[model samples]
Each structure stands twice: as C-alpha cells, then as structure tokens.
Target chain A: MMPAALSEATPLLSVRDLTVRFRSGRETVTAIDRVSFDVPRGRVLGLVGESGSGKSVTALALMRLLSPDMAEIAGEVRFDGRDLVALPEGEMRRVRGRHLSMIFQEPMTSLNPIASIGNQICEPLRLHLGLGRKAARDRAAELLAMVAIPEPRRRLDQYPHELSGGMRQRVVIAMAIACEPRLIIADEPTTALDVTTQAQILDLLRDLQSRLGMAIVMITHDLGVVAEFADHVQVMYAGRGVERAAVRDVFGHPRHPYTGGLLRCIPDFDGDQDRLVGIDGTVPSLTNLPPGCAYAPRCERAQDDCRIVVPDLEAVAPAHRAACFHPLEFAREVSP
Target chain B: MLNYIARRLIYIPLSLLLVLCAAFVVLRATGNPIDIFLDPNHTPEQADVLTARLHLDQPILVQFVIYLRDVLRGDFGDSLQFGGPAMPAVLDRLGATLELLAAALGVALVLGIFGGIACAVWRDRTPDFLISTIAIAAQSMPSFWLGILLIQIFAVDLRWLPTSGRGDGWHLILPAATLAAFVLPNFVLITRTSMLEVMGEPFVVTGKAKGLSAAKLLFTHVFPNALNPILSFLGIQVGRLVAGSIVTETIFSWPGIGRLLIGSIFQRDVPIVLAGVVVVSLFIILANLIVDLLLSINDPRIRLG
Candidate 1:
C-alpha cells in the first residue's frame, strides 16, 4: 500500500479561487463559493459534504462541463502547471481526455445507452492518441479485458442496454483509465451503486490510481467512504471548506464542531446504539445562507460573536485546520 | 404473432360487413332506389311496375341476405356511374396511393431524422435555428396551400418540374415534396425534442468522460436513444399522410384513390367510396403495426402477449 509509481513530491492539480455563478431572472446565485484545493500525485483527496454543498460543482468546474447559459465562471484552475481556465476550447478538449478525466456517480445513466462498451472505451484513444483503426480496436478489447468484462470480444459488438448497472459502471471506469490521465475526479462514484459493488468500484479505483500514479479527487457525502479510502480530507458546508486535515488528524481530534457533529452522526459498527448522535437542523438554502459562519445557526456551541463574525480557516494543529468560533474537545483516543 | 395476424384479419371482415350494411341501408332507406333510377315524368303505376321488374318488390330481409351473400363472394356490382367492377378499380387505385405515401414517408424519414440530430447537436447555433424555423413554417401552412404554392413556383413558373403524376418523368417532385413537407415537420420536431432530452442526460457527460467527440456521440448515442418515442409519431404521420393525400391528389390531378373516391362521392357511388375509406384505413393500421414492431426492437421494452 506504499506509493508505487508516484514520487513523494508533486501536486498534479491546483484549484485557486474558483467561482461559479448562476442567474435566475433578476437574481444571481453563486453555486460554488470561492474555493481552493490541491490534489497531490497518487493521493486521494476525499471531499466530504452534505448534499447541495457544491462538492459536485467543484468537480464539474474543473472539466468546464457546465452549460453555457447556466454557469458564469471566473478563476484559476491549473493542472500539470498549465492554466486550464484560459485555455481555448480546442486545446481544452485535447486535455480533457488525455491529461485529465472524470467519472460521474450514477452507473446506470452514465454509459451511452446505444453504443457498444468497446466503442465507448476506444473513443479517447481514437480521438487523442490517433492510433490506427485496428490498433484502436485491439486496445479497446484490451481495456475490456483489463476491466474484467467476460468475453471481451463479444462485448465489443453488444450495446449498453445489454449490460447491468454494475457492468456499465465498470465500462465507464475502463474508459476513464483508457488514456491514463494525471488526474481523475470521481464525483460520488459509488453513491448510486449497491454496497458490494461500491466496495469493488472503490478497490478498482484505488488499484488504478496507484498503478497510474494519478491524483484522485473523490467527492462524496458519506463519511464512511472517506474512512475507507481517503488519505486526506476536506469538509465543506454552504460551499466553503470548513475543515481540512489528514484523515488521522480529522477523525482523531475533531477541531470543528461541524466535523465533530458529522463524525458523531455516523453509526459506529462496534458501539452502544444509544451513543449515536445526529445534527438536528437541516442544511440552509444556499441562496439564503445564514449570516456569519454558515454552521453557527446549527452549532450547539455557537457563541454570541459566532452569529455575527465569519471564521476563516485557521490551524488547530500541524497540518490540521478548522473554520469555527469554538473548537470541540478532542478525546484522548478515537471512538473507533 | 399469429394470433395478432388472426385478430387483425377478423377485423377486416367485420369492417366490410358494416360498410356493406351502411351501403345497403342508406342507399334504399333514404329514397326509393327504383324511383331514383327511373324518370320522374312516369306515373306512380309505371314507377311501381318498373320497381317490381327491378326486384324492388322482394321482401327487405330477403334482399339484404342476398346482397350480403353477393358482397361476400366479391360480386360488388358495377358502379351506376362508372359501369365497371368495384373491386378492380379500388385495388388498382389503392396501389397508386400506397406508392405515393411510401415515397413521401421515405423522404420525410431521412430528412427529418438527420435534420433533427443536426439541430439538437447545434442547438442555438445558426443552423439549428434555420432548420427549426423552416420546419415550423412548413408545418404551420396547410398542405393544400403548400401544394398549390409549390405547383405555382416549380411547375408553372419555373417550369423545371412537372405539376403532378407518379411517373418515370419529372412529375413526382412536386406532389412528393408536398406530402413530405407536411409529414417532415412532425418527424423533425419530435426527433428534435427527444434528442434534446437525451442530450441533457448525465450519460452524455459520461460519454464525454469516455472521450467521445461530437460526431461519434451524435450518431451512436444521441440519435439511437432519441429514436424511440419518435416511432409513434412516425406511425401517426403515415396514417395522416394517407388521408391527406386526397387533397394533394385532387390538386395535382393524380389518378390515385383519393381522386377516385371524390369522383365516386359525386356520383353517389357509395361502394367505391366505402372501398377507398376501407383501403386507407387498412394501410394506416398496417403502418402502425410495423412501426410498433420496430419500436419494440429498438427499445426492448414493448412486447406482445
């Protein structure tokens, strides 16, 4: 489980002050608040959040996949030391499949319903790699075989409707790794899948990540998924990062009350059932976010100033930071 | 499949029986058949003698049974006006209408589908705007008016094409274009709408995630998935085109069944008129069945008991 092909130092993607906005009639809604993060080579950065927290928006913003009239974006996104924000559409297309790739959460609706699994896998190679037709087809078969699809050759001629939801997602993963990109932004990749399939997909992703030495941004709402996969973690609320730290530091000594509430919310496998706790209030509407720290309205430890003053990301310990007016008490040991 | 065929076949007889009954009842029930057939100057006694000679003296039940029996045997008597066997004339002209409808539907399918896919892929682009505008404009105009306008422009003034007739000569261009223009918009619009919906699915992004380019995505993905709902639209249009060909055929002076039916209606030749309706209805039903079969194959959801 040591870093295999990756060097110890090298950040593959840098997102800086990326802002995305939507306009409805006369009202303007900023979907993604100015956000920044770094994904190191061969590292898994788990982006944890509740729904409508702009976790998916951050991933979509990287690929420039938002609709033309819907999204207004401005900010710096640099991948492999190259600025992606200002690149022309033509050049960005070349970069999308070759140097960068992404997988969506829904396995069912993600594959083209009419195209054969093989054709879907071969698309990037044919477009960007410029391999000859026979070689591209041969590589497509190889990809299916690598993904462990049974009878890879016959699958080449079979359409997407013939495959189950799990197989279709496997096809999607095969296509993602076809070009062996430097960065793979898998947005809630296992959320739509069954429990057993989710584990297999996670394992496949991790195996491929280490072998390819690719940086992965695993965005999810599930804290349990982060525990199993993420080496580093960033928790977001109201489109802003509230806490970020190593996985050990994050769950072991919970600094932010939001992070503490989130960790307590999860049902422990080996614990007294009565001890499990959940935050009471629902997430506030992004269009009408609460004043001061967005979590203050829901935080039981909120002070008078916490309702008026915003908290910036400040270090609680080495390589650990939280945005909170009052930090939580860290137990001597994690609850396991 | 055989049960379906058998069920449909049963409807054919049941349909013809009703038509035969209507023809018999309406023809005689409205007025004295012999009186209408004979001179008005004749006396009542003369009219009675003439009716008796013509077998109008027979009991109504006896007449109906004999009539139904004759019709079942395909001895549809001569049209009072045309003085020819009804079945042969109906069958001959049904062929002509079928040919026109097939050609028109063929043209509509090719142009509508490809144009729709193009418009959806380039939505909000100039070409998409242009295709949609043309389809809407064509769809808004009456087919009869469109036919007249096309005749005036291409056939009468420009003289580059013939006015009418389905022939080896340059006669098909205008009428075929007339039918196609009417059918094309529904096809294009349905396709465009469905294609837009399919394009919006998260899977298209998945396809993009797989690194598919514009051309491959449209043909392989967008076009096929969008094709499902449009099958019903296409079937409905085929039936409309068959019924609609009456106006087009009349305007163009084409000797198809529509023109024949109009002539029969003028002559009070009810048998041939009924035959025309029957033929067109059969064609509509058949086209729909074929379309349903194709749809089941495409979507894999629809199946028969």
Candidate 2:
C-alpha cells in the first residue's frame, strides 16, 4: 500500500477527537464519541455507518449546522488553515457555501418545492460568488447541462415536483457544486433513489470530483458504493469510528470483528451460500452505551476482557487501523 | 386547470339557487309582514288590498317564482322602513362594511403573519410563548364582548376614541379592532404552525447549508414555501369576515349592511331583510371566488381554467 502521508500542503479537511453530546433533561447523551478522520485534497473519504452511528451528526457538526445551545461540540475541525470548530457564525457563513457544501439524503424533499430549479441553483452562486442575475442564471443552465439534465434552460423554470427522482438528485448535485467548493459532504445521497439512478448519481459525483479536483466525504452504509468511489473508508459504530484504512486495505484485510462482520454480510456472486450473513445485535443506544468497546457485545471473537475494556484504534497494518481486542485473522478474508 | 376552475364556477349558481329558495321559505314561515304595520284603525278590507298589492295573497310557490324572476331582473322590491328599493339601500350601506373589512383584514394580516413568523423563528422561547398565549386568548374571545371591551377602555374610560358610529377613520378603530381581534389569532396560529412545519423540511436545511442568513432563509425559502396553504386559508377567512361583519356592525352602530339587516328583521320588513341577506350572500360568494382565483395565481401548481 502507498504511504498516504500528509503532503506539504494541509489536508483539505482534518477532524481530530471530535465529540458531540446533547443535554436532554438531566442526562448527557453522546451523539459522536471522539470521532476522527481526514480527507486529502481531491480524494474521496467514505464514512460507512448504520443508523444512529453519528455519520449524519458528524457531517452536521462539520458544517456547524447543529444548534450550538442544544448540542455541546468539542473537537478540532481544521480546514484550509482555519479551525472550523472555533469559527464565529459570521465567518462560518463565508466558509460554508464558498469553501464547503453538502448534498442531503432525500432528493424528493431536499429542494425548496416552490422555488424554481434554476433559481435554487443560482442562489449559492449569487450569494457566494457575487454573480449577477443574468450571469448566475446562465451559469445555472451550464451546471444543469453538466449534470446531463436534458433541456437545461427549460428545466430551470420548473419546480422540483416536475422533475423525476434522478433529475432532482442531479439538480441537488448541481447546487452543491455551484460554487466549486474545495470539499463536499454528501450524506446517503442515493438512499432514496432507485438502483439505476444511484449508479448514475455515483458516476456523476465521480466525474465532478475528477474534473473539479474537489475532495468528497461520502457518508453511506453501502460499502459497494465506497468500493467503487472512495480512496479511504472509515467504519463507525455506536457514535464512534471503529476502523480506518484505505478502501482496498479495509476490504482486503478487515482486522476488526465488526468490520469483518459487515463485510461478511455482503452477498458474494460465486458463493454457494443460500442465505446472507448479518451481524447479531443492533447498534447500541446513545444514552445507554456499554462501558467497553461499543461493538464488543456483537463481536463473534469477543473475549471476557472485551466486555470490560474499551479498545483503542491501534495500527494493524500500514495505513490501516481497527479497534478490537482480538483482531480477525486473514484466512477468512473474501477478495474484492 | 381551466377545467378545475370551470367546475368550481358551475357550483356557484346552484348554491345561490339553493340559498334563494331556502331564504324564501324561511321568510314566509315567520308570519305576515302586513300584520306588523297594521294599526287598530285599519279595516280588514285595507289589509286585503295591501296583501294583494304586494302579491302576498298569491300561492307560496307562485310568490317564490315571482321573487326568483324579479331577482333575476335586478329588482329586490321596496324597503318597509326606508321606502326605497331595498337593493339600493343595502348597496349604499355596503361601503361602510367594506371599509371595516379592509381595516380589519389589514391589521389581522400584518399583525398575525408577522407575529406568527416571530413565534416560529423563536419557538419555545419567551417571545413565542407570549405570542402564542395572546393568540389563544384572542381566538377564544367573542367579537361582541371584544367590541364592548374596546369601547369600555378606549371610548368610555380613556375618552381617546368614540364609543360608536362611523364617520372618519378614528370612528372605525373600535369596530375594526374588534373584528381584527377575532381574525388575528387564526392567522397567527396557521402561519406559526405551517412555518414551523416547513422549517423542518429538507430544503430549509439545504438553505441553511447554503450559508443564507436567517432572514433570507425565512423570507426566500421558508416563508414562500409556507405561503400557499396560508393563502388558501386566508381566502376562506376573508369570505367569513364579510359575512361575520353583521355582529360587529350592529355592536358598533357603524351603519353597515349588518346593522341595516338587523333593523329590518325587527320591523318584519320581509323584502328589505331578504334583499339584504341575498346581497350579503352574493358578496361572500364573490369574495370566495376571487380568493380561489388568487390562490391559483399565487401557486403555479394550482392551475385555473
């Protein structure tokens, strides 16, 4: 594997020891527990996690979208030489659309329904880039064309309801890329779309990333998507990342039992198994997390001590790390 | 869209016919109009002549047909007290009612919508709580009582405004305020509720993520998106306000159609009362029709024929 070290310039986005907690009533619930990762310039980082695993929360935290009064955030989110966690809202506003952007999960609802598609696309450009009305409008049409939306000019005047699901997702992508932000965070961008549409959107994202040379934080539970697009993969469990590695290393040598369990759940094309494998237990609740490793209760290779002691994310290989008391052996690996 | 509008339009005449028929039957059931005007000196022959002259001696069905035909011909008969065409009398008083409606609606909309927006933006905060409480209290308060309360405070006690009657803008204050109080709560509640719901929508999140200021996000994305439902709601409320002006006008002695209608009822002036009812009904229906058209115009998704 390549060294994958930080080059001379700063990483596009670097998050370290990010913790998020909510004070509801008298209890303090941890939403994101010491989560950390980095996205190098122009590379894709796939954050793989199931529901309640802090994937979306992390994205919201990065964008400072969560209410500060409600959610207590403690972390260092350094991007382009500034600590986003410490930035004031006014300065944060400038960084948001101009330097960073996000695409949401549901295309059906992720647009202002009454707003014309063209106007919505032109909004960020006008606000961030200071483009004139005619110029922004023209640029919006170009973006639509870039996303392969047919009759881009006409589609601009149409409302979101007039467009198909795939078309709406494309429009969402067009909005995210409007300002040419250095980084884009897309959370489950294709979960609401059909399989065919999902593939098209993923392809569009890949094409845009290469052409624009922008980093992407692709958050999804679908490993297949990560394998196809991401350079690095981070597997999160119970509000914290349990594994971090290059996409190939994580897939080829899944050292953590939870990561191995996730990989085993994926159906193989040539395997003779009639039923697919699934992990035994559900993700732990935020307010009632176990004292030990969050995935220990569900780990097949769990030891007695694993139930009492939390595991640190220690290095298992070059550019590969996993949090597990007893790491998985390589003999059970399924080649990607 | 055209088909939808045409279909809605076709229901109007049918509804008017029903209302006309109902009003005719109900008015006759109330007893003889001539008996109320008779003095002890009047002989039975005089009563008969009066009854025949007014076509009251005819069969009920015949009278109804004549009434319908006359109404179609723009004749609403003569007023018993005023002794002129009842239609013209009612039409003359309509201006006062319209003025009250305009002022009331203007206050209700401005206060209600802005207050609702404030509540939604600061939901669960102190301002939200205060505004919501006021809205609830206003909604529950009857217009008659509210009018008296306004008169008691501003007219009787403070002497800052007139107790009753409409001449200048100052005289309109109490009545319009009472009516506006009745309407304001609904606007506040609906706007707050709808805006809160829309604020939770994914697009709102997208707007925030796009670095839009709170004000821009609200007016541009949240408020506009939340407006269609409120517009349709406002249409219904406006139509209701026109009809509801009866009580407000009577309490304030504002010389509107409502006050005139009540006086005609006490006088057993059937033609005048019926004319007033029909005119007011027509106004309400027309207002609602305009509202429907406006709703369609505001929302492109709502196509009109």
Number of the top DockQ candidate: 2
Q: RMSD to native for every prediction?
A: 5.0, 3.0
Q: Which tens-of-lDDT digit does each residue in B1-305 have in candidate 2?
A: 67767877898888789889999878777877577656658899989988987688898789889889998887877877988888888889989988999999999999999999999999999999999999999899998899998999999999999999988889998999999998899999999999999998988889989999889999999988788778778878976787568889999999998889888888787778888888877777777787787777656666622
Top-TM-score candidate index: 2
Recovery fraction of native interface contacts for candidate 2: 0.67
Evaluated on chain B only, candidate 1 has a TM-score of 0.82
- Two-chain DockQ for each candidate model: 0.43, 0.70
User: What's the true lDDT of residue B50 in model 2?
Assistant: 84
Stretches off by above 4 angstroms in model 1 are A1-9, A131-138, A273-275, A329-336, B1-84, B91-99, B106-140, B145-174, B274-278, B293-297, B300-305
Candidate 2 chain A has its poorest 10 consecutive residues by lDDT at A1-10
On a 0 to 100 scale, what is the lDDT of residue B294 in model 2?
70
Model 2 chain B poorest ten-residue lDDT run: B296-305
